[model samples]
Target chain A: MRLSIENLYHTYGKGLAFETAALKDVSFTIEEGEFVSFIGSTGCGKSTLAQHLNGLLKPDSGRVLVDGKDINEKTPEAMALRHRIGLVFQYPEYQLFEETVLKDVMFGPKNLGCSEEDALRRSRGALSLVSIDPDIFGQRSPFELSGGQKRRVAIAGVLAMEPELLILDEPTAGLDPQGHDEILDMVLALRKNPKLSIVMISHNMADVVELSDKILLLSHGELLKLGTPQEVFGDAELMARSGILPPPAASFVRRLAEKNSFFSSLSPALTTEAAAEEIAKALQGKFE
Target chain B: MENIIEVKNITFSYPESEEDAPAEPTLKDLSLDIRNGEFVAIVGPNGSGKSTLAKCLNALLLPEEGKVCVAGMDTSDEDLIWKIRSQVGMVFQNPDNQLVSSVVEDDVAFGPENLGVDPAEIRRRVDEALKAVNMYDNRRKGPHQLSGGQKQRVAIAGVLAMQSSCMIFDEPTAMLDPSGRAEIIDVICDLHRQGKTIVLITHFMEEAAKADRIVVLKDGQLAMEGTPLEVFAREDRLREMKLVLPFAIELADQLKARGIELPKDIVTEEDLMAALESLTAGRKTAGEAVPCA
Candidate 1:
């Protein structure tokens, strides 16, 4: 799905003593099959914007368009359009309340009015896509699974909806290093569908750099910058201003460039392997 | 310094359900000591028993076999449970769940209040604890009004008000954003400077690198234990345990693979930068051609 947000404005506790703008005049477009990431410090309205994409929140003013059609319209077609965008919330495992893992995943498809058999098939497919063995874990209670498994099961619930565009809010938050990698791998595998677009909201800059095709930076309810990972993370000053750090390799190269002229010629690298390769080449030239 | 906590061959397992015949022990014969005023970080993959070991530290979950002692008080002794608990405070992963009262100061005061400390003493402790975490200004604000970092600080303050000599934080920054994570880590470091024994259980290798000592667990057993320099140097073993190295160490490893010689002790970003700067500095002094700006 091609999603676009135009001049989105939202406020909480309007006209009250503590009235605050949660999102303000934010605008961005997400192309089909593109992996987009929304990143900013906490309370920068990343989550607020994610909700808007799926019509979970009504914008006080502005439009959310899915495939050139406004999703906020009061029509059956608009409602179905909104369902095509699935949002997996932070700590989504807390929402799992089913006796069996398969049943839990089937809940979303079933709720969307799919037949029982159809929902079961979708649930099995989703679980397998997440690398969970549906045959092995299908009958087990979700609560009995490990923390990482429970989180994946929760994600599978969203996948069972068969969303054209999926928005995950901090999908790897609270997971161990291995679990974190697993989730990222699952996301990559899901993209194999070719028709599924993803919008990830994450604090891990490294993961953002590794996965995102395009990045949307939000700062205090405003769309600060929208560009490729290199474009967004390349600017050290902007990252500092937004209260976020660049990916490790980028930050290291930037710091090195600041301290020495020799390192200044090296571009900011997003991954450690790339940074190491560049540094090694530079050192080889100097020594040889 | 003397040991504040000692776990000797402790084993723990959750009760089995009807479907699962028997549950494996979460922690198996795990033995370790936390020195008084020492900062220790426990790291492992999920189900590696980091949280279970933390619970065992505070007597929240007693070991099924062996013993856990806090400052010479045995955790298995029913009467000493409260005494041990009061001495070792725990801060959990989720900030919202740990908070009890709507107001920040009220929440901080809850611990001492439960201990039946007089109101005057509770007031003094609350003020000191809130100030310590740098949340003095937000004391009057409702917890819901604070950010994730602020809420975690308030949670730390709640433990501080109880005058616990040792604090066990179980992935306290797991749910926080980058800035919030930094805030909590800063508070933890500050507390450590104040001579409070710290037991930090975290998955963030960078956070663990700050601790004086690091312990690695795997399959419910102690896999490795040493200073950060010692444990981080063994990249192969750490990878086997499913733990990622800190960014600097990971980079250093990659550099080493590319035939770059860096000091083995490099763990933090600062260490890596200094090592690279020195290497480049030597080349500059050798009269290498300067690259264009």
Candidate 2:
């Protein structure tokens, strides 16, 4: 699905003394089936923009469009569109409430009015989608599991819904190194399927580098820059100006290039894989 | 030679879960000695007992089998709970949950007041604590009104008001943004530099690299312990422990795998860049540099 936000503004407590504009004139689009990352400093309206897509938040001004159709159309199709967009909150595990993991995973599809059999089937598939063992763990209580396990079960709940677009708001927070990588790999795999559109709100630049096809930079609730990861990370000056730190790898590669023209010439190889390839070639040349 | 905090074969388990594994300690017989004014980072994958270790340090949970001594006071001594906590201030993972008072200054004062300090003394300590965390300007602000980072700083300030000679942070940056995490790390280091023994429990390799000592825990046992370079130098061991290194270290390791001449102890972006520059610099200064590939 292609998600488009036009002239969007989100204000809390309108017409009151506590009135604060959380988002001001923020607009961007996620092309169909593209992995788009939303990066910004804290309180930069990344979450606000994501909430706008599913009607969880209504814009104070302007509109949100999914597949060129305005989401605020007040039609049954608009309501259906909301279901097609799955919004996973941060610490989704905290939201899990069912007695068993299977029931919890099946909750979303069941809410969508799927048959008992169908919901259970999707739940099984979803458990596997998140790399959980459906037979063993699905029968146990979510509370009985570890923190990382609870998180995967919660994500499975959303996956069971089988939405076209998955909006993950800091899904990797509080996870240890192994747990963080597992979630990131799940995300990276989903992006490769060529049908899932992703809108990830992340503080980890490494995630953005590996997963995002386009980067939408937000600053003070306004759109700062929208481009490919390379293009966005290539501009060290712009990243610094926008109060966003570049991914460690991009920032490192750039600093390397600054001290040596060879690295700078390679320019926008921001990922670790890319950096290694460039240096390997440079070394092979040195030997020859 | 002077250790501010010492753990002698300590073991701990939640009171409720004590019987779940009676034979084995939920936290194994771990031993450590933290010198005054040192910033030490304790890291492991989830359920590796880092948080349990932090709680044990402050006597929130007593050891089932051994002992935890904070500033020479044994955690097993019930009467010393307050004194132990005051001496070793703790900052939890979630600041929102830990903060009891609504306003900043009041929260800071709460710590001092709980220790039976005088009203005037509490006021002075509160102000001093807030200033230490750079939250003095927001003294009157509501905790809800502050950002996550600021709220955490306020929490730290509250901890500081107790005038603790030691501080323990349990995954403090786990819930914060990069800048927020950076700010918290700076404050933690600042406190350490002021002669307070600091123990940081986290999963972030980058943050752990900044510490003077890095201890990796696995399966409730100490898997590895050393300086950041010493711990990270064993790439295979770290990867085997299910721990992640800083991106720079991983990037440098990848280059090393491909037979590139780069330092293995690269912990930060700038460090790796500087190392790479020197790798090329010596050549450029040579009689004739190698041509580009």
Candidate 3:
């Protein structure tokens, strides 16, 4: 799906004494199959924007268009369109309330009017896509699984809906390094299907740099920048102003540049491998 | 320094729902000591008993087989449970769940109020705790008004108000943004500097690197324990246990593999940068002497 937000504005406790604009004049587009990321400091409206994308929150004065049709319109078609964009909230595992993992995953599809047979098929496919073996885990209670496994099952519930655009809000939060990588690998694997588009909200700059094709930077309810990872991270001043640090590799390279003129000419590498290669190349003569 | 908290031969297991089967032990025969004023980080992959161990420390979950003592009070003793809790405060992963009161100062005052401290003493402790976390200015604000980091700081202040000498944090920064994570870590470091014994359970290796010592857990067992430099040097073992090295250590490993000469003891970002700077200084002198074309 081609999802676009045009001049989105959202206010919390509107008209109350504590009224605050959560999102302000925000605009962006997620082309088909594009891996988009939203990043900012806490309370910067990243979550508010994600909720608007899936029609969970109506924009105060803007439009959320899925395939050029307003998702918020009060029509049967718009409601159906909203289902095509699935939002897996942060700590989604808490939403699991079924007797078994398989049933929990099938809940979404069943809610959308899928037949039992169809829902079962979709649920199994989703489970396997997340690398959870349905034959083994399908019979077990969702609560019995490990933390990472429970999170994957919760994501599988959204995937069972077969959303063309999947929105994950900090999917890897509270997970260990291995579990974090597992989720990222699952995202990469999902992108292999040309029809699936993914939007991830994350605090890990390294993961964002490695995974996102485009990044939307929000600060104090304003869309500060929308560009590719390189374009976004290359501007040190922009990053500093946003109160977000560059990826570790990029930050280390920038620090090196500040101390030595020779290193100043080198482009900041976003990944550790690239940064190590750059540093090694620079110090080649000394080692030899 | 005296050991503020001690875990001795502890093997803990949850009750099995099935009558015929027994639940697996979540923590197995683990023994550890936390010295007074020491900051220790515990890291492991998911389901490795990190949180289980944290719960054991403060008597949130008592060990089935062994004993836990906090400042000479046994956790198993019914009379000392409240005293032990007061001596070792715990901050959890979710900031929203830990908070009780609507206003920040009131929330911080909740712990001391529950202990039935004098009202004047409660007021003084609340003010001091809020100031320590740098949230004194937001004392009157509702808990909902604060950001995630601010909320976490409030949670920390709530613990601080209890006047706990040792703080056990279980993934406190997990739900925060990068800046929020930094803010919480800074508060934690500041608390540690003030001579509080700290037990930090985290998945973030970079945060763990700042601790005085590192404890690695795997399959409910202590896999490794040492200073950051000593523990991080065993890259293969850490990877085997499904833990990643801190960014600097990982980068240094990659650089060393590519024949870059860096000291093996490097763990933190500062150490790596210093080593690289000195190497660059060496290269500069060599460049002048050789006059490379």
Candidate 4:
């Protein structure tokens, strides 16, 4: 489904003595099946923007359009639209409350009034999608699992709802490298669904380079930059101003340019593989 | 090098594991000495007992069969545990888990007060600690209002207020973002520069690259221990342990495998460029910035 947010403004403690404008005139769009990423410094309305996409929070001014439908709290269809968009929060394990993993995963589908047999089936399918063994872990309590495992289960619980637009807020935070590997793999594998759209927020530039198709930069609640990760990292001065560190590949290329005036300009590099390839070819030209 | 902390044939088992698990021990005859002012990092996969080793350093977890000495003080002595902890303050993974007071300054003061420091002395330490972590401006702010990175800075400040000679961080940046991790690392490096011994435990290989020495823990044993270059050069061993090498090292290794003339010592982006520029010197003309290792 297409999601368009236009001139959105949200303030906490409105009319109170301590009002804070978290988001101001924020405008962005995510087409169906597109992978969009929102990046900004801390408390710059990244999370606030994501919350408006699904009905978790309403905008004080402006509108959130889900397939041209306004998703305001006043709308009769707002509750149903909540099911269409699934959000796996920053730390989702905090929301889990069930005796068994199956029960936890079934929470979404069951809430949507699916029958027991169908809820069980959806829960099992979601469990398998996250690579968790259903038979082995279905009956087990979530508290007994490791922090990473619990997070996956929490994500699967959201997946059980079959959301068309999947929003993940720092899905790999606080995980070990291996756990990070597993989490990203799960996120990438979900692309096989074909109909699903993914919107993820990440502070790690490396991960963002790997995942995002469109990178939206939010600086102090403003739409600073919206383009490919390559475009964003290419501007060294702006990146430095925003306090966003370039991915190591970009940094390496920039460093090389500084020393060798012959190599005055280079395309943006993301992964280590790309950097090595581009640098090697550039060096060959330099020597030959 | 003079040893500040010595580990001698240590062995330990957590109390609540499976009874029939054969008592495999968390630390198996592990022995090492941390030089007085060295910056060391311990890295291993989950459940590898790197944290267990950290706890043992400050007497939080005593070794069942061996001894851990911090500046010549034995860990097993009950009366000396508090003194040892003061000498080697620790910062844990979760900042929220350790901070006790509501305000930033109050939280920092908690550590000095615990040692029964003089009121005026505690006030001095509190200011010094906040300044050390760069959290002096937010001293009056409530702990809950600060961001995750700021909270971690407060935690570092808390540990600093105790006047510890050495600091140990048990994956202190695990819960923080890239910026937060950078901030905490900067604090650790500053402390190291100021002549305080630092031992940091982390899963991020890139972070480990910044350390002077690296100790790899596996199943509660010392699998590998050496400088960053020495340990990272052994890609096969690190991979087998489910540990990833730094991106720079991986890129260098990839080029080396492809028959390019990159050196084994190329562990950083700067080093990689240096090696490349030397080979491509003829094409590089005036004003072309050439890299140097």
Candidate 3 falls in which docking quality class? Answer: medium
Per-candidate DockQ vs. reference: 0.54, 0.53, 0.50, 0.40
Per residue, candidate 4 scores C-alpha lDDT tens digits across B1-293 of 68889999999987764433446777788887899999999999877889899999999999988899988999999989888999999999888888898899999999888789999999999999999999999999998789888998898898888888889999998888778888989999999999999999999888899889999999888999999999998989999988998878888876766557876787666677778677657665423545443
Return the DockQ of model 3: 0.50
| lDDT of candidate 2 over A1-288, digit per residue (tens) | 888889999998899999888889877888778988899999888898888988899888999888988888789999888888999999999999999999999889999999999999999998988888999898888987877788989988998999888999998988888888889878876777677898899998888888888999999888889999988888878898888888776666666656676554554577788878876666456556
What is the RMSD of candidate 3? Answer: 2.1
- Evaluate fnat for each of the predicted models and list the values in order: 0.61, 0.60, 0.48, 0.38
**Across residues B110-217, which tens digit of lDDT does each residue of candidate 1 receive?**
999999999999999999999999999989999989999899999999999999999999999999988899999999999999999999999999999999999998
Give a tens-digit lDDT track for model 2, residues B86-157: 788888889789788877898888878877999989888888888999999999989989889999999998
- Ten residues in a row with the worst lDDT in model 4 chain B? B284-293
Question: Which RMSD does model 4 reach against the true structure?
Answer: 3.0
Candidate 4 runs further than 4 Å off: B17-25, B276-293
Poorest 10 consecutive residues by lDDT, candidate 1 chain B: B284-293
Between prediction 1 and prediction 4, the one with superior lDDT is 1
Better of 1 and 3 by DockQ: 1
Candidate 3 chain B: worst-modelled 10 consecutive residues by lDDT: B282-291
lDDT of 3 at A249: 94
